[model samples]
Target: MSKISAYILFLSLFLLAACDSAKKEFETLKEGEILLDINTEEYSLNGTVLGKTATDISVIDDVIDKPLYKELCDTRGKFLEEALGNGESIDIFELAKLHVDDNLSYVDFYKALSSMYFCGYSDFNIAIGTNYKDVFQLSIPRTDYMWCGLVIQRMKGLRYKYLRNRQKLSLSEMSEIDVEDRECVEEYKGLDLLLSFYRKDDGIAYVVSLNETFFNKGSRFDGYNFYTFNNDADLWKFIEDIRSKVDRQIGNMPGKKEDKVLRLLANAHGPNKVMLVFQKDVLMKDIAPIVKKLNTYGYRFAFDLD
Candidate 1:
């Protein structure tokens, strides 16, 4: 084939591929359904979906309930006893202190629990609490009692500040728009750790803003990112990959720092409708483990090239 003919053929293929990519199907879920229901018997514990649509997913078990807490406490105490040896002076308070002092990453903390069977493969539950006293809260318990509460407290305050600042920006932008002859009041909706809503004078609903910690570095409280969509099935599939890798690494001992970082980035950006920009070369391999792990969680993994 002539050079021009070959070039035309390649271009046609590329355009067809692009058109195919643009077409995506969305699935809706009703409330109280298990967004990522994993049958422990059929699936590996390491594999679990991270995201669930509010309408479709059901609650498998509330790991935060009192009974679960008690079980965890008893198991953790036993592990500590063995680690410290028989009759070595140790208390829960002291153990908590050590966890805080070390500033251990999630990987290290998970390893500590798994080593003693105090904890097993589990997805880190990320909850957004109601606004109270003008503060937003995001709470995820520490597998280790000593530092988990403190860490959560600090994270809640930081998340509040980040969301509040972003809201201010959104409101300011709305105000600058011309509304000389139109209604000018801003209707504020409830706020949460993950999302805030607002209605403008023009009757357009706006998503106030998501927490900034997911994208910003040097924000001491930076950990994971939360993405929202009209549909959550695809997002959850991606999340399962991350959860699987995290669980597998912790089980193996000596979890890698890179894994944690990549998981954070993917969790924060993967579900967004917009394109994500990052230091690709630096985060490339770090992201691979997460993608590989997602398969165990039962998600058909695919990249959003668009």
Candidate 2:
């Protein structure tokens, strides 16, 4: 074939594949139903289609319940036991003494350290308390990028659930608009489950959209997340890193979900908080192992679908 004809053929194939990529991810899940398949890197975990959206998907993860908490407490405790690499217990009161680096002033260092260690994750018993006063708050210092000039590590599963108190921005307002022109995002052409790690002003955030992002035109979610991270550079880097990944498989595809559906109730909190909605034959399952796969890659979900 001539060079022009060869190029035309390749372009046609690419467009066709791009159009079908989103639909194909759905087809892969429904061996029968929208059976959820948590994807780690090794394989796909299949389950009935629990919840879906115009351009996103979600599976159940129940690492927040008590029985499961009881089951994993020893393991978590063991991890805590090895805190700071010294295998010593860290008391909350002594949190101000943590000296992670030279640049971190004692006050800012303590604040970051407290954000990491305080406000109980294990205390959650299917419901999040109504007050942000008790919630763990993270501060984003000025930086060239998300963490470039800041001396901090983004925490996985970290949440800034204060969206309930903040005013809700309509989908159009919250959408990430390109100042230059209508954004033509490079379509995600892979069938891999879309999981992402993000840095927000309030804390590190995680998102697992079906195949599109909150900013994608195809994404029809009515919700919008509140942002306190005023650093434009940081926000740019966060979204760019997600959009530019060579592949979206952030971790090993999860296997089977265990028994019981562990839930975190931001009870009084408005239900519109969750961006992706998913459900299944109700009951808690072992979310720890599957969640660990995402955490290993630094994506942790903190809210729930009520």
Candidate 3:
């Protein structure tokens, strides 16, 4: 074919393909759904028809809006007193220390922690340790980004739960928003679960690849541990095995070393960190349960924010 004719043919094919793509996108969008084409890399969007796109977004640490904070305190004031001293004035962390066990159950302590976290005290921290109160100091270690990130995500969840009820958005509309829950904060039982299972010197990070059919487990970034789980039961079993080994190791340690190990485990950068590798297409509904389970073990979750 002549050059001019070949160029014209290529243009026609390009237009045809573009039209086909547009048709597919249009078909997937429902009547009430609006399509957005965003180029900035600061926002991540998850939707059924639009597909999923993740970006390098920092967790928003904005204090809960005053009106909503007031609403929360008003309705849950009695519950709030469990953590906040006198239900109003006092350093919350100091107050938490006083009731570390006297008045607070593990569950209740976490509830108070969540209240304080959402109430603008983002410095509060937790970790896998014997004394949970020791980890609740105002000076959270700078290395504990995973724990901080989890709280931020939990706050995001709470904001959605509270505000959505007020806006009265339809179920269909609500589904589009990725509302990770506040449960991870309140439901965390790291101290109760005895999750200090790794040797303090080992420095192992459990990075799990959440696949479609199974989970790929890795102890180091160098390679996978060759352990794949087709079910949650197997994953729990593997963790138990690690715990058993840790117990044996601790039994053999000198008393001084054992004490040192305990102190090390309480630090935020300790062995209780897990990096969950998720495919972009994975839904938050599927991710939430696993996250909650991990939180129960006092496992701080890290993600590929990049």
Best candidate, TM-score:
3
Q: What is the C-alpha RMSD of each candidate to the true structure, in Å?
A: 19.7, 22.8, 23.1
Best first by TM-score, ranked? 3, 1, 2
- Scored against the true structure, residue 124 in model 2 reaches a CA lDDT of 20
lDDT of 2: 0.29
Each model's lDDT comes to 0.30, 0.29, 0.35
TM-score of each: 0.21, 0.20, 0.30
- What TM-score, to 2 decimals, does candidate 3 have? 0.30
Candidate 1 C-alpha lDDT tens digits along 1-306: 999999999999997676444321101222211111122112111123323212111222221323323444554456566757765544332222001011212222222223222333122221111111111111122355344334332332333333321333333332344222112222211111233222245532212233343233333321324443232355555444444544443345434876776655444433321211112112222333333333344322211110
What are the per-residue Cα lDDT tens digits for candidate 3 across 7-51? 999999997787666445432532212222212222111121222
Best by lDDT: 3
The TM-score of candidate 1 is 0.21
In candidate 3, clashing pairs total 0
In model 1, how large is the Cα lDDT of residue 64? Answer: 31
Clashing residue pair totals per candidate (backbone < 3 A):
12, 27, 0
Compute the lDDT of residue 262 as modeled in candidate 1: 63
